[model samples]
Target: MCKILFINNCQLYFIIYISLPTLEKDNEIIDIDPFTVFGLFNKSSMKEINRKSIIKYIADEFNINAKIPTSFNSIPVLNNQNATFYNFIGYRNDSDIDDLWELFSSALDYSKNPTQANRDKVSKFFDRVINQKGNGNSKITMGLYWISPDTFLNLDSRNTWYIYEAGKIPDNIVSILPKVEEKISANKYFDIMKKISEYLKSSASNLKNFKELSFEAWRYSEEINHKEKSKKVQSQRDDKGSGLADEDVDTIHYWIYTPGEGARKWDEFYEKGIMGIGWEKIGDLNQYSTKEEMKKAMKEKINPNGSFMNDALATWQFVYEMKKGDIIFVKKGRTQIIGRGVVVSDYYFDTTLDSEFPNLRNVKWTHKGEWEHPGQAITKTLTDITPFTNYVEKLEALFSEDNDGEIFKEQEIEYPIYDRNKFLEEVYMDEEDYDTLLELVRNKKNVILQGPPGVGKTYAAKRLAYSMMGVKDQTRIMMVQFHQSYSYEDFIEGFRPSITDGGFEIKKGSFYNFCKKAADDIENEYFFIIDEINRGNISKIFGELFMLIENDKRGNSLQLLYSNEKFFVPKNIYIIGMMNTADRSLAFIDYALRRRFAFFEIKPGFKSKGFSIYTKQLNNKKLNSLIECVERLNNVIADDETLGEGFLIGHSYFCNIDEVNDKVLSNIVEYELIPLIKEYWFDEPSKVKEWADYLRSAIK
Candidate 1:
């Protein structure tokens, strides 16, 4: 590499630009892709990266053990104990260490000779370890840096991405770094970082060290900051429009996204059938544990305004929260709707994508043209408009005009698998009990799972249907909660106000529509789950359909009071109702309704093999003690004349928790269990406090 020359002519300055020679070692050509990273946490905030301390800790701790030649204790273990640190990536657990230690030890030799041949060996070793193929490159580079920080810089994804953003990387770099999971030789990785670092150092006026170069790379890399934001140009298209066939309006989430200012990316995204966003510097967002972590990375690399919490949140939601089948209303400028799309795929970070927007999701663009929203939409990059039902309805109505009353249909079926075994593990129930419940539903056609709170009644109802159906099949399952105000008008067809009619139009209720859908597909069984079934006035809600719910009368046709049309409960439809027996405000189910449907008592299963296995696997003394105490309390409640077994404390409160710790136990005791206990024994204040103290002490 040629040396850059600087000449001082009086007080003025003259700088010379020189293209460096190709780096060679051992008579071999050295090639490394440009704009690859090392680090960038904005030195000022994360504490300056200490060079001497990092090297010293590596020398002391990371040296190979003679007893286990391929092993060098874990870096994360030292991190757990607050040992001296280095900021790097890809060592999530000790497995990566154990998997790559043989390759990792080679760094000591590479540092000694620092040959191109040896550097190539590290990358080749990574590919050989097939288990680590995805994250192999990350480990090798950081592992090499750990041994010799100065000789081999740790260019993490964040660092490489920033260098790309700074425009230091040539266009050809994409051919080399083709995907997020790029595998480059260690020789090439170091060569590229050295070239970029040297170039950054030579170009600056007062840059002192490599750390400052990191800060400069971060500061200079820019686009679409608040200052460059375009002025609002309202869309000239008319506000009113129409949409296509409606399905699952309640489940769909509506969103608005801009390809770029004035819809510059419309052609690319529309033709490719995709929608995407910038902020490619953060790498694959899935790696971030939470939205807050994604936001933190955005702050250091993208320099997003910390005060704009919603703006920061949009970046994370774009990758993780956005789901397939969600609606997207594409907009150009403020209030201008350019297109409508349905998400067809999950978010992916494709490095080969258009560099401007590397994060993407495949979309089926249904409509493309100019239309205006009834109101000015949120100006954020992405906005969830599902809450604005009226606005969404109007938007759909506008799209309905495109075909001039002629419309087409598009169907996408997604059946997530949830079989009987999964149901057994999750519901804290055994095979015999599960078989009985399924048989009861099939025989009775309508059954209520009556249990105390935390017995997993509602949880089991959905899964029971899943196990019966053999697939999750959300399309076949419909769940609705019934309350005091629920009625025939809400559960069946009813007249409601319409904008165009300027009068009332018959609007179909959720259950009525679901029944119609099920009736159309008579061969397949459909399950309808009603939560808090006892809360609503059953006679008022069911109306004439009350008699039809009986297994024999299911296929019998009935005339509706409102529409006067022949409607029959499909023979294939089954009902699963849930009743919280602990709710004392209500009386027993009507005798007329009770006899038609089977009532299944779902008891607490603390002693069930599933629950026992779950508890042992968690292996927490506090959790074990707490469960034993709850069991004793359940016995006391069962014996009480006022409460009995129906209102006993359930085991669901402790089920499926990720871990049993003091914080979780305390929350359950203070907020969940204690409140229920206070309500259960309201007449006896001392008793309530006694049980509360007992439960609290069990965890403590």
Candidate 2:
């Protein structure tokens, strides 16, 4: 027998020719040196030789599968008999390559045939599989390539270097890779895997062959390195650039959550500098291998009731789905929103935390204040509100760098308890008017709903406040009618006799009390609505607050009259004042307060879509004709020199579609509109009679 021997780099390699017995017997040893046989190729050629022949030969000697073994019998041998992805060999010596293949097969087919206990087993196995490859092992790439040739690319030191040279990695990853002395960290490896997965799944690029793409990338990277070494000058930055591209950013979901029972620990969360949920019995979610397993654990422990599954699902989302960089909004009680932040760390179980809220994530809170109570309270412990575009826009605005604590400004008024549109329709107001009114209120921070009597100014004012708030939270809203007797002492703070006891107490007026309430809950919005605002002494009742009510002066402190305490109207508090324009005896509003408030004229709403819809629902031809007559009467009233458009008989007189008929219409015409007409044209009795005859004919 003869053995062919080759020697290089202080290591020996021999090719055995055992069957050549004649040559062995003759001692015909070919004395040709292996260097002469192989030829003196440069270091670069040697690297290629090492990559193609030496590395592949070593892998082959270990019986690497031909064309990726489909069955267990065709797989390469595993040195550790019981080696598995989840755990190291544990006393079982009989386990073989088939067991390992079974594990990998389960992982490969995991998404399709998933088991509750093994839900996270695949991800856990992934790390183990990578770790099991040992240092500088290229078999991991081989396995991935075998599984999905089109999806997975090879990962090794050389290929990693290729990717690095291309400058397509995050600075953190770039910083860590070269410093890794033993093995790449699971985080870095997983990050790379995520990047590759994203690139392959991107809809922008149509790439099929991952292997070829990887080879080209490596080759190009090598060329770049060579050019840099030869020229000895800093090269132009690669177009590939570092880190994830804008399109490559993971689809991040924004969520709102209230922690603990009734948000008891919400203050603690903001104080503790963290955001979290309350499910400690389930233990650390990170310890679970799969979401299904975590859910199983939750189902076993948690009270399985209505929305339990949904709550558990939200918990799963919090633990697993919520990645670092996701936005989180914290809701306190049902009225206030606070602590807007970006998740800065992975989900962790804080054992030191009380049982109420132990599952936590680190967050960098960007803003903290009361958001004008957005509609109804956030009921869900965790809710994804990404589907609502308006909420998203508001969220973006709140999180912006220059945002001056403007939170929950715009709100969607779709609540089960409050039928905003129905209320508007009842008041004969249209959606366009409602939106405009809300916008005016939002921008100006102070607004007045002024219109003629019977135009639904008072009715529309409260509904308008509710619509702007997104919920009809009566606690956040207070209504006070201004009158001749209503003074600074009564509207603001003053000493008043207490009814409960025979003593005097310092009484907090409606405005003062409302401002204090607003200040206490700065995270929520409060409304101080004044009906017949012009009926009171405009400058007297408001006093020093007249200047403070300006949008810019909100939150600026001023000395009070009675208590002498420094006070200011909170930014979260919005003032909505109602004025009856037909009451011309009332003094004109102080110009100082006039500029501060946005005056929205509440018209008769005869041409309003709400009125049209209401009339259509009633479907009364006579009533419709009555509306036309009222419109004609309004034109005549508007043309009058004494009684102008402001004094026109409003649609509110004909608004009660449910109650309006010949009798109710006649009563309104005879007792209401006739009297108003008599007052307007007392001198021109014929003019009043003409309009009354016209109105009476419609009711007839």
Candidate 3:
């Protein structure tokens, strides 16, 4: 945390980067004002100072027992009835504090040891908490995170930036936080924290505690905050608005709308895969101003109905609000999921269709197979299941096997790009190198990670996308391997034999598809990662895309030789190419293509603190010695004129210390290490044997 404090008129004024509120000092009150810290917020003025000294000052002045509070209200009462309670946490007054404590404490107790009677109490308590003031809701969440460091990540702009920066949160978690500065309710905050903890535990399973992980998240958030300030200044100069709003990014909404009454028309609906509301008599909703008006009109025309207002609203939504790209699931009497499809067209009234299904929307059916239903039946003809977390997960699972489920066509919604901090935590690379990689990618738009095998080039590429997007959106990322057979026809756009037509058809390649998707959401970033980039004929594969791949040439129209269609690589699409430097058989990338991409050399990360932390957890002397031996071997390899840097073994081979043992080490040495060394010194058999023997001796 950075703070700039200066003395003005003999009064101390503090400008804080991270909040360090105040503590009891010799039974005297010392309170600091609490304000929202934003990514672009800036304060000018100060001297560099130690944060520890500030804490020490408070500690030296007063002595307070360092223990968890016995009761929730004790957090305020024991700390001297100060307004800092409201500043630090969300306690409005004594009465509010008492009321919050009673509810919060009961919920906590129920969570610790829940029973059938109090099973729903946690949800009830969360609802009460969420209904509090927005600022207070956040402040209280921060306090909760502080008390349960093991379970929760703090809810603040800084912490949120960190989580987004890491780009490692699960897809479901990303679904919850779709935009920047999105207000999180109490239940949402808890849900986000739970997911984050689960992710942290999996990624950093070797760690004894999450303290370092939490600090890293905060520190990274601060880093992003600084970057955001710089970006703000640049954006101001560039005359660009702050990208896209949360609503601008299209999302996949799940809906369960039964086709006909009692689902007798389930098979026909499944076959058609269309979503429509049955209120044929209500007429087209575009003519009506409000649901009430429509309902009144419906009453006069149809004469008797039961609970028609709700049905009218559903019809209105089906006609006007249900968007393209929103996913639909047709259900039948809670027994089975009949079909799944995406709404491809806006609602329309088709008199030619069956009278029972006149009000309809076109759907691109992805799956028509029966899937075992997971939840209770939905009665409404058009129900948005996006808000129901449980239902959403179940529906997502039902379509989880679909290979193309993540990517959707153009929609009028916005999505976030990756976060940098999260990328560093996941990839075992130094902060300096990680920051450098990010800069290269930002400036160049296309970056090639070239290094020895096992340097994590491929692993880093996908995560790099996630970190940049700030969301784990697989749809925004596309990966393909380049081989000798890969060609321009395969990469950009080419004519292919049509299976259905029995003739040549113009097929859109992955890159072409990706560019179109990116062009749709020009505000968001998309990633195209190519593995073994040097293995393919770069010149042949890129073709005219070579010109379009350049940053300046982006959006420059060109006529494809095959398709003869106007095409342009979108500005939002970033290219990440991976090349194994040790593969001597492959030629260097074409000079033209090389000039377009920023080349980043990824080295074996043996000296990284993350690797050190990982190895320390193994707590085995032999494992430590093995690392030392590998470092020595790397030095020797680097010194060798014939087998220089490219041939040096990567840390990834030695990173798996979790299952390390004499047998595992021996297998790695004999099979992997020795073979790599032999290839490095193929002309010198004696030298290869010497290094292999020495390597084997270290493992023994």
Q: Pick the candidate with the highest TM-score.
A: 1
- Once fitted onto the true fold, the runs of candidate 2 whose alpha carbons sit more than 4 angstroms away are 1-427, 498-503
The whole-model C-alpha lDDT of candidate 3 against the native structure comes to: 0.64
lDDT of 2 at 359: 84
Q: What ranking emerges by lDDT with the best candidate at the front?
A: 1, 3, 2
- What are the models' TM-scores? 0.60, 0.41, 0.46
Candidate 3 lDDT, 1-700, residue by residue in tens = 1131221112222432333323223323223222121101112111113233333333333453454222121011111222233233333433433445455555556546656455356556445544555334445545444445454445544455555656644555567663434445545655665565565567544333345555666445544544454344333322101111123333445678777876677667657766666666655454455567667767856766655787777765675456677788878776678777878886666646757667888887777667778746667667877655345656767876654556433344444555766676557899999889889998899999999888888878878877888886756777788899999888887787654347877777768877887998899899988988889999899887888899888889999888688999888889999999888887455888789999998898888877777887877777677778878988998999876887678888876556778987888788888898888888989988888778778866
Off by over 4 Å in 3: 1-339, 342-418
lDDT, model 3, position 103? 50
| Local distance difference test, each candidate | 0.66, 0.61, 0.64
Put down candidate 2 lDDT per residue, 1-700, tens digits, no spaces.
0123322322323422111111111333333222111122112212222323443443354565554222221112112222122222332223322334543555457435546444355445445544543312244443444455454445645555655655654455455443332344434544555565565456633433456556665555545553433222112111111111112123345788786767677677777778777666666554454456666766666654424567666776776566666678777776777667777776666767655577888887776766654445557788876545345555565555424634433222233345566567556777777778888988899999888878988778766666666665655777777888889987787887654355776767667867876888898888777877878888888889988988898989999988889999889988888888788687477786688889998888888877787788888777887789988988988897887877877777776557656777777778888898788888998888898899889867
lDDT tens readout by residue for model 1, 378-497 = 678798776555567678877875544566454567666768888888788877988898899999999999989989897788778878888767668777888988888888878877
